[model samples]
Target: MAANALLKTQSPTFASPNSALDNIVLEYSISYFLIDLLHYLIFFPTDILFILHHLATLYVFLTCRYIIHHGAFAFFMLLILAEVTSLCQNIWTLAGFRRADLPAAAKLYEFLSPPFYALYTLVRGILGPLLVYKMVVFYLSGVAENLIPRWAWVSWMFVIITAILVSIVWVFDHWVDWFKGRNYKAAKKVV
Candidate 1:
């Protein structure tokens, strides 16, 4: 009964859409898929070579950005380049996974296999911070007055410290797990 209710809540229903509209939607989907494949082929390099180039590109970009006193326009251009490269890298990754037949697509599907709640959580976690930060930055830039209070700055400092401490702890834990392997098994068991 619970599973049935879950399925009902999750499943999409087409409430008698006209045949013409349905055909249009199908045509759009096919076009989108073809375009995606074309982009993948044209933009992305093959597997190992692409990985090496991706890493090299990232290193060069970061090094140059850090060393050079580029204007905002230059920074923006670099950001755009980074975005395009990243997109191409992702496409190459997906293609490599597909060619390897290493359950690449299945792994993505499995991430939200439990359905609606799992999908919701995944989307929320990924997009929530991104949307919030974009809005905050936009608003902060527009308004001259400091939106974040002095106290809020202190709170942020604390959060940063806590994050650093947590990361350190995680690194130590992972190191211990690697050394013992028993600890790794125990950690997985706890999870």
Candidate 2:
């Protein structure tokens, strides 16, 4: 849906107004965030990072949907990029949660960790930042001033950069852990 909206736009910038398709996609994303926020609040209340992330995301989507009625192009692009790894991430996370108790889950977790980390790092660390840098540069050039106010774009940048940094740190930690485990196994085998 988001990709379709982006494709339909003749030439999209960060400040493009919300089309009907854009609104539909934005609404779908908004619903996802809202439900996910509630899930976090109910089941994972201690996970403040995810909670705050959901809140910040909701703020961006809601403002774009109702208040500004623009910026869907940038947000939708970011959404598609961010979600590209979600399936793999979710599987890895579920396996991680059950790994200690289930042998099958342990195997799955071990199998998926490296690939998940690599894919996540590539998307969140490299591609995401490049796109956001473009957004920052475009907005800083003051071309979108009439469409998206300074406050809106600034807030969006803050949320996006923060989220990407957190994701990078998370995947980096996994990579470190994976390497350490491999080295431990190799040392034990030599002994």
Candidate 3:
């Protein structure tokens, strides 16, 4: 992440999306695959949506790196933005599981929950809809520029669209509850 941030600050690749492998993208791809693997083995049906999301993310990154040749800059930026609150999400969930006996941990989770929800809504809710719009624009502009096999491009776009739809629904489902002061404490586990 430090390297990715440094590169973003020092080296602008806006006009020309590099075809070379970015360390950050590579790292994220590996991490997502590992997460998918673990979830597939451990949770299976319990968190099938997350497992599918992870798989789709891994597929998108792998295809972007190896097959598709367009939109690295946009993809990397989206990936970074999407993961900005990952640490907070992990900590919040872990705190939930352990908070039953740890008063300090519960206090910390409570303090962090509001900010986490805010960030989640901003990125996964608002930005996600914007991304779906961009996807449409990009497709209409020229899906051919992607240069990958037709099946790969189609599947990637399909995954993204479905993910965005899921995110929108999830956000709407949770927003009222969040505002009502009933947090995920009793909600379905995301896993």
Candidate 4:
């Protein structure tokens, strides 16, 4: 989807009508988020953050797919930025969960951590914000008000901005931990 968005000569805009491909992508994304939201609600009921994230994501996809029938291009591009590091991050997280019990998992976690963190930081902290800024600029210009309503774009921006902020904070916390561990190791060596 991201490749499609990037490679298309005639780029779809926030106001462009949904293509057949866009509908497929939007439906798949909506289903994934809905199922994940249900899982969190049932098993991790107290996991408010994940639940809210899923809900917010569903809102964006649902609105884009059903309500506005536009903005798939924007959503697809953002999806690319948001999910580029998901596989690596997921592997790292799974390894982390088992690291204490298994030496191999620990090794894998250690090996993957730095690269994953770097990629994630670059994508979420830098690229994501850049793309979002462009999206915001376009949306706020009121060019697409007829196709995509003001309220929809404004709410989407709110959700996107909040998600990005949370991602930045999450990655920053990891970076702090990594630096502290490195410093501690260096001090221990000196001692």
The candidate that wins on TM-score is 2
Query: How does model 4 fare in lDDT?
Result: 0.87
Q: Write the per-residue lDDT of candidate 2 for residues 1-191, one digit (tens) a residue.
A: 99999999867888998999999999999999999999999999999989999999999999999999989999988898989999999999999999999999999999998888889898889999999999999999999999899998998899889999998888888899899999999999999
TM-scores for every predicted model: 0.22, 0.97, 0.72, 0.92
- Model 4: runs farther than 4 Å from truth? 1-11
Between candidates 3 and 4, the one scoring higher on TM-score is 4
Give the per-residue lDDT digits (tens) of candidate 3, residues 145-186: 444455755676688778877876766765676666564554
Q: Could you give candidate 4's per-residue lDDT for residues 26-85 as a string of tens digits? A: 898898898989988998899898899999999999998888888888888889887899
Report the error of model 3 at residue 60, Å. 1.0
Local accuracy by lDDT, each model: 0.36, 0.92, 0.66, 0.87
For model 1 the local lDDT of residue 182 reads: 51
**Worst 10-residue stretch by lDDT in candidate 1?**
9-18
For model 4, give the RMSD to the true fold.
1.8
lDDT of 2 at 183: 100
Which residue pairs collide, candidate 4? Answer: none
Q: How do the residues 1-191 of candidate 1 rate in per-residue lDDT, one tens digit apiece?
A: 21222233322211111133333333343354455545545766454433443343333323222332111222122233233334434554465456546676645533322342233233333333343344345434533124334343233333323433443453356445445755666889999
Best by lDDT: 2
TM-score of 1: 0.22
Say which prediction, candidate 2 or candidate 3, comes out ahead on TM-score.
2
Q: Alpha carbon lDDT of residue 174, candidate 3?
A: 57
Off by over 4 Å in 2: none
